[model samples]
Target: MTWNPSDFNNTSGLHISPKDMWIPELIIHNAVGDTYELRTSNFMKLAISSNGFINWNTGGNTETSCKVDISRYPFDTQTCHILIGKSSSLDYELMMIPAAAKINTFLYDENENGEWELLDTSVGYHAINEQMTFLKCTLILKRRPLFYILNILLPVILLSLMNVLSFKLSINCGERMSYSVALFLTFIVLLNIVADEMPKVSKTISFLQLYINTQLAIGMFITTISVFLVHSTNSKTNDDVTGAVHAVYKFCKLCSKKQQVRPESPKGDDQHEDKYIKSGQCEKLEMEHVQQTPGSANAETNQSPSIVDAVNVIDDTLFWSFLMLFVLITIVFLLLCLF
Candidate 1:
């Protein structure tokens, strides 16, 4: 509201105090689409300063809803606007000076908000419509990621690493599948928590959600691998052992025999066996027939696949695969956050 307090002054060169006169207080226009819920009453306190200067204070806080963009999440910045103006133009005419020197922003308690840092503010005139002009204060906020790093990200990364390490657990332990499933459930809970914190809009996905989804995929992969390994490692009869397992066992046996033989033996028919042994494939025992045949240990065909060996092979393979995948994921996410 705008008014000249001197209008009530006497023509006899007498002074008039604003304390004895009425000063209009500006109120927010209701027709604006974006609005805030005031935390205090609408009544304002009028102050009559020296020289008949008048000042009105409408001190309050607003709990308004803002459009949230969580694509960067822990490293994101948000801008919120607060509009103020006359509620109606019935009794008074309002005017404003568009000068940056007239505006002042001073927060008494800046440290009250721990998660968000006040970056800066922007003030300007916003035309609500042809009939209304509003003063808008735009507040820019940045999220402080230190707390989230210590509390949320650390635990999630450790959980993923633990899941990778679970591949080392023996199939005979009977806890491999259970451990993987437990980690998978934990990932689900974390993902849900992240989703709940965000607004349900069709914007870009958050970085935290991307990481969580990748971890969930890794967990499911480990669980499936565990189930397959346990099933393959638990076969009681050698008849059920597939050709793949037989091939692996024979290859391993050949490598062991090649390591045992120090001197170079004859290279007649053993030449073919030498190629397979060197290439880590099945090697024919030619001159080495005098030595103990790997198949003779069990009195069956060329070396049967041992359950313990098969389990170990699967565990070793999964451990390396999961580790490499985790490293790749970490690099990709770090680059995303940095850029």
Candidate 2:
């Protein structure tokens, strides 16, 4: 707080209220350390007439670019400083004093601001060599997590789940790759939005940054897996293909065979025998054809590119890998941030 009395005779026993007298102009100087910008405004007011004197009050809300420590991020605390002093007058010519009753008597209530809660306020004197002393007020604030949880964390988590679900799409379709790429781009855009809210300086890695980086890496990995799955469909089923691709074809054939239903035995007599004889003849002809070209049917099925036999294998592998990574990253982030 600051004030000045103009056109007042201190020698006179009569009082001179600011409302009745011309007020003096005073300017404040930057007395805090050189780490923040000076951001404040001043409002002057006249006080009630007193016994033999009058008083004037001058001060206003200040908002500066305070240095932030985001190690805890949504749970962080910050201290900001404000200084009030005469700009042109030295200590010998003019002095600053704090009101005894008002200093350090204020308590901060919770949820007063959306993102930050005022925790404490303090008053002190900062001396500059032997020429000046400035009154400084320091405010302590803590972040409120409700806003960020609703805005940032929840959306990223949903995006991560969407990325995992992308693997369920058919690798034969081009939409699989396109969908995954779109999700990856969405994650990047959300991360950029978050970056805009953070300080430009990188004194320490924030927990939010770590979470975003982990999610982005996961998205990239998912995209890479999708690309590989798409490429796997273009491979031929010849013997020149790798053992892994052959194993994938074998697995697909086994799964298909398990899904096939066996025909039931006939329950009747003479008609059944006739039908059985005809079926036996057909089976004998099929066996002769198989003998002529041993593995032709299996080879033809494996060589078909319309259906990628290896895609299911790739999709299942990627799903489990992504799940484990997601769980591990979440646990670590929780331990580091909430604990």
Candidate 3:
């Protein structure tokens, strides 16, 4: 086999030499159709003008196998042009053609007009465009099991576990509110991260969204319960209040008992304190009044006698009323948590 160097014309001001001439073979593999479209811009030429181009047609090619030779002349640049046809009837709308094509490079050289000989081989792929040459490959529409476990499942499980902490903290103290606020903010951060990842499309709520919303609602409930419990605890009628109520009742009863016996005496000294004075003179004066007026005696006998009895009755009633109120509140809270 012999190599030929055809004569070339140099219209531009440049010397045409033969010593630095070499040909590089460009091979196409996994061609899609009977004819593939190959543009001349893909080739690398050493000594040719940027505009100097060639269009070689690979006519009558097979679907699976095809080859072309370009070793006739020492041209600075070489490019091939061909058209490819589709053979299958399958829908190609969803198919990505550019992702399927892989390319490799092979070097060939000639020594003193001998046949072209292979030197070395290299493997690489043609990029879709210059901007896409260094693209980072990523998977689409397929959920990576490991990523789901880490990003979605793990976070949701951790958030749910945090909710259980609410039960440990006392509802009347700051622990409930503080823990709830912290968990709520955590859910907000996770929600924001999830929102950024997903496309803004209107549809059913995602699993992650449902999880976050549930956690938020639980936190809100915990906060509300904490507030209610604090209010209930603080709203108690303590011993001082009960004592004051009993004292009021006793004083009213004592005043009524004394008014029945004693005349309306405006000149009396400290009537409230004098009414409580246990003196024989007051008792004799009350007896003389009762004997003179049978109606007064009947009224005194019909009326409840002692202030201490009235105080005891009032105290018992208040104690039972507050106990029932506390019990009702506890039952309601229990029902809410159960359901």
Candidate 4:
């Protein structure tokens, strides 16, 4: 019996039987709108009976009906264009969807008369086919090297330099004020840089923020110590000046007292007598003063102003205070570096 074309879809011709002497072919199409046609002759046959019981045979196996081996087709050559859209939420929720895509499939086969059949169709791959598989995609996260340099290293360096200024500046009001101001400015700049890169989350403390705060604390401590040193040195200097003035006054008073106890010489005698009297009076006064003031007394009472001593005391105190401050600041800076 002749096969009725209207009774069977054209796709049924893709399957064949060995007894029927029919062949089957498969074709594939690509996304670039290219068609690849493949043909096979006598690949399938069928056993036709008077009651229309057609038995299909393929690969030396007889079946009740024809079947097509889709595996023989080059599915790899046919690819679909997949446009994926992804969105992420603040809570780390991710969503993805295929917004648009298209697939092309090509069919080629031979009829019972050995005629060729070729067809091409463009349809949504997912609409007609549910068995299509996709390859697993790997996601990678890459960070720029310069991001760490600018966002981390540069800020830390600036902060460290600001901290170093505490040691370089003099421990005076002017120097302290300037250094503190500069340190604060550096902190502000670093904070701004951190704010730009990090999310405004209440629960997190960035590395840059920690570093800036630590440096600011150290700078404040250094400023306070400097102020204390200046005040202490001035107070000590004032005390020394007061003590020196008091000693000088006491020495002058003792000299005045000795002068008041001495007696004068007689004046109405001859020239030689007057001269001898003056000399005797002077000698007596000297002896009496020497007798009253013994060696121990002289040793105890003698006081002389020493310019060198005053200068040395002032210089030594100031120098040592500044030196100690310098060393302390240096040690603190070194510790910060290590940490």
lDDT of each: 0.68, 0.68, 0.44, 0.43
lDDT of 4 by residue, 1-339 (tens): 446555666323343444345323322322124333222224545556434455443322211211122111111112223221111121123322222332222232323322112223232322222323221221111223345455555665556555545544443335656666676677777667666755455553444455556666655665565455445435563333335434544554455466585455455647646645564665776668878978865775554434334333333443444455545654554354334
Q: Estimate the TM-score of every prediction.
A: 0.68, 0.62, 0.32, 0.31
Give per-model CA RMSD: 7.7, 12.1, 27.0, 28.9
Greater lDDT among 2 and 3 belongs to 2
Which TM-score value belongs to model 2?
0.62
lDDT of 3 by residue, 1-339 (tens): 121233334343232332344222222334555334322223332344324532232223334332222121111012222223222222232222333322222231234323222233223333444332221221111122445457754675566566544555543455656776787788778778777765454543454555556666765665564454444435555422233444555665565565586455456577645664656756777778888998868786656433334434443443344345435543543344233
- Rank ordering of all candidates by lDDT, starting from the highest: 1, 2, 3, 4
Question: Which of the numbered candidates is closest to the native, going by highest lDDT?
Answer: 1
Positional deviation of 315 in candidate 2, in angstroms? 3.3
Regions of model 4 farther than 4 Å from truth: 1-138, 234-339
Candidate with more favorable, higher lDDT: 1 or 4: 1
lDDT pick, better of 2 and 4: 2
